[model samples]
Target: MSDAAELGAFLKARRAALDPADLGLPPGISHRRVKGLRREELAQLAGISVDYYTRLEQGRAKNVSDAILDALARALRLDPGEESYLHNLAAPKRREKPAPRRVRPELQQLLDAIQAPAFVFGRYLDVLAWNALGGAVAFAFAELEERNIAKLSFLGDRGKELYPEWDAVSREVVANLRTEGGKHPGDPEFARLVDELSRGSAEFRALWAEHAVREKAQGWKVLRNPVVGELRLRYETLRLPDDPDQGLVVYHAEPGSESERALGLLASWIAADERPVNTRSPHPHAG
Candidate 1:
């Protein structure tokens, strides 16, 4: 969608979600035609002309002032994230497709060195690189066809099983994807991902229509690992400043907890499997 269309759709969706009683407006006797606040009522509350508000909703308004956007956000009862998303939709910046992601050798080494599960994610949440533990403990990096977190969360069932708090995590993933979508408006790959997911998953379609935005960051997750049973893990995401679109996410279990013990067992098992075999004969005289 064009920026104007996106802006208009977002305005309409937010307006439709509000209730007159919730906003302390009297429930009138007349049957209302619109679902929520009428355009004129919203304009009156926002201290703007009805015609101006109409034009804004109809994608005809240009050079929208911050004052108006702020007022509308207030009138619509938007949260900080929602307000920021609204602003982005109103004034979008075009972004070129990012170059193909390549994990530096040093960064790959860093992932290998970490005792905990760690992986690198590119702009679209593609699993660019991961250590053995990351692949074993979390979702299988090599198993995924697209290696995209959003796809796994919505289009597949792996995320539902992996994350105990699946609903919240799925929403966050969608919101993060939405934020990325706003940042790169006409990106073909991004648009294709959205289209594919929207068609493949009803949940994705519903959430995508809401126009939520969020930045992916550190969070705790309860994972149901087939080998380890249930484990509570804290994850931290560190963005590469040199390449802002790339981030390294590491998952750690709390020290001395059952989860930590499970991780230790996993580490031991992996180490044993990777141990080199002694090939040379000991001595000619040895029995």
Candidate 2:
């Protein structure tokens, strides 16, 4: 979709999600055609003219001011991520073509040094690099034919089996993808990933249509690992400052918990498997 169309859709979806009663508006006796606040009602709430708001929603208004955007955001009660997404859709910055993603040597070293499960992800949540435990604890990073997380979460059955909170995590993944799509509207790879997932998965199609925006940060997840059984881990995502398109995700369990013991067992298994590694030339494997 074009930026204008996306902006309009986002505005329409958010507007429809609100209730008049929540915004201190009385429910009229007349039958309402729309589900949420009317255009005029939202305009009044945002301190803007009805005509101006209409034009904005219809993608006719160009060069919207920050003040008006902030007003609209407040009127819609958007969270920080959603508000930022709105601003991007409304007035996106011109972007140059993105380069092919590569894991930095330093990042690879950091992943190797970390005792916990750690992996680096690039655009579209591609597994750029992962340590031994990362591959063992979660899905095998080396085995995935399609390394993109969205494709794995929606299209791959293993993802559903792996994540105990699969439904919630899948929705969050879609939201984060939506945020990335808005930021890089011109990226063909990102666009292709969305198109492929939407075509392959009905659930993905339904969720993507909602246009939710989110940032993947700290979160707790329960995974049914084949080796460790049920492992509950807290994950933290750290974005590579120099490379905004990449993030390092590390998973840890609380001290002396069952999950912690499970992690320790996983580490031991990985260590035992790697003990007989040859010092000769390493075989190249696609991630």
Candidate 3:
């Protein structure tokens, strides 16, 4: 979608998610007719006119001021990530042509050196690179043809079994994808992935429609591995400043927990195998 169109959809979604009763906006038949606060209510809260707000939502407004965007963000109760997304949709920069991302040799060395589960995700959440233990703990990155993380999360390789908290994990995956999609409006690869998932999974379609933008940083990840049963670990997502399209996700368990021992066992399994796939995991940007 165009940035302006997306800007409008985002405004509508956020407005639909709020409650007039909580804000004491004098609920009545209109409140019941619509799901959330009326457009006029939101415009009043943001100190804008109803006509102007409607224009903004219809993608008809141009050269919007930062003050207006800020007010809208505050009125919508957007989180930092969502707020950033809102700004991107309001004022987009030059579009970069979709290009394939490659994990540098040194970066791959770093992944191999780390004793934890570490892998790299590309612009569309493709598993671009991973160490031995990383592959073992998660899905075998070497075994898959399409290593896109979002696709695996929703459609392939018994991923639901791999992620015990499937519902939360899947929702967060869609949100992250949404954030990426917003950054590069009209990206064909993103459109392909979205179309594919929307056709394959009903739940994914519902979450995608919600327009909730999220970027994963650091969090507790639980995995139910066929090899090691339930393995709980902490994960950190590190983005490369030079290559904004790539991010490294590293996972570790607590020092003395069974989860740590599970990592050790996975390490042993990885050490025994010699999968000669390209560890850099070079994949073409979705066509």
Candidate 4:
């Protein structure tokens, strides 16, 4: 399918997956004809005409003002990440600005200095670079033949083992991708990745249908550390000051905690088994 057509399908599908109750709409009967908020319902929430919203979803709307876009975003109850995605879709020209070549060197150096595990990632969640500790915490990076997170989550058995909550992780991954895909509808690489995963995994198909989006800013992670059994670590996502698309994702554990010891052991194991690689080497950057 054409890129624009594919994007339209993706946006529509995601919109359909959201329930009216999610947006605080009164509970409609289960026998309602549609699964999610109806087109008119969404229009009412956005304080726009149904015709206008329909045109946008149909990929026929033009000159979508920022105010209108913001209204739509608010009506959709989009998170900051998802709201950005919506704006990108309305104005495809913005994404033409290339992401910066290197994340600030200071940022990279800082990530390296952190004794704990950390990695800096671009907007697409491309793995620009990571410290030795970072590699140790998420062992899947070393094992990844491709660095793209979506591909790994859906296509590889290793991801299943690495992500303790595989189902939840997969859903978030798909949702995030849905937001990205909406923003860069014409991005060939993004389309190709989605097609490859959709064709390869049924689990992907189901989650893709749910149409959720998330910013991978900060969260708790439970990983099956190959070296340290299982460790539950808290990760904070720090957005680089200059690079909006790139951020340092650092993992840490509470002090005097077993997870902390496991992290140290995992670091030692990485030091022993894997050579420290460049932060910019060709690796799939998946968020």
Identify the leading candidate in terms of lDDT. Answer: 3
Q: Tell me each candidate's TM-score.
A: 0.82, 0.91, 0.92, 0.81
> Order of candidates by lDDT, top first?
3, 2, 1, 4
Backbone clashes for every candidate come to 0, 0, 0, 8
Candidate 1 weakest ten by summed lDDT: 278-287
- Report clash pairs, candidate 1: none
The sequence of per-residue lDDT tens digits that candidate 2 reaches over residues 14-112 is 998898888889756237787888889899999999999998888788888999999999999999989988888887558766643667677777888
Model 1 RMSD vs true structure: 8.5
Candidate whose TM-score is highest: 3
Residue lDDT tens for model 1, 18-130: 88888878766248787888888889899999999998888888879899999999999988867877787777466675645677778878988787888887767777888
Write model 3 residue lDDT over 1-287, tens digit each, in one string: 67788889989999999988777676453527879888988999999999999999899999888899999999988899998888887774685776556777899999989988899888888888898788878887777778888888888547788888988898899999999777777677778889999999888899988998988788888999778889999999998998887889999899999999988988787677675544554555433
Please rank every candidate by TM-score, starting with the best. 3, 2, 1, 4
Report how far residue 167 has shifted in candidate 4, in Å.
1.1
Off by over 4 Å in 4: 1-30, 92-107, 140-145, 180-185, 268-287
Residue pairs of candidate 3 with colliding backbone atoms:
none
The local distance difference test score of each candidate is 0.80, 0.82, 0.84, 0.70
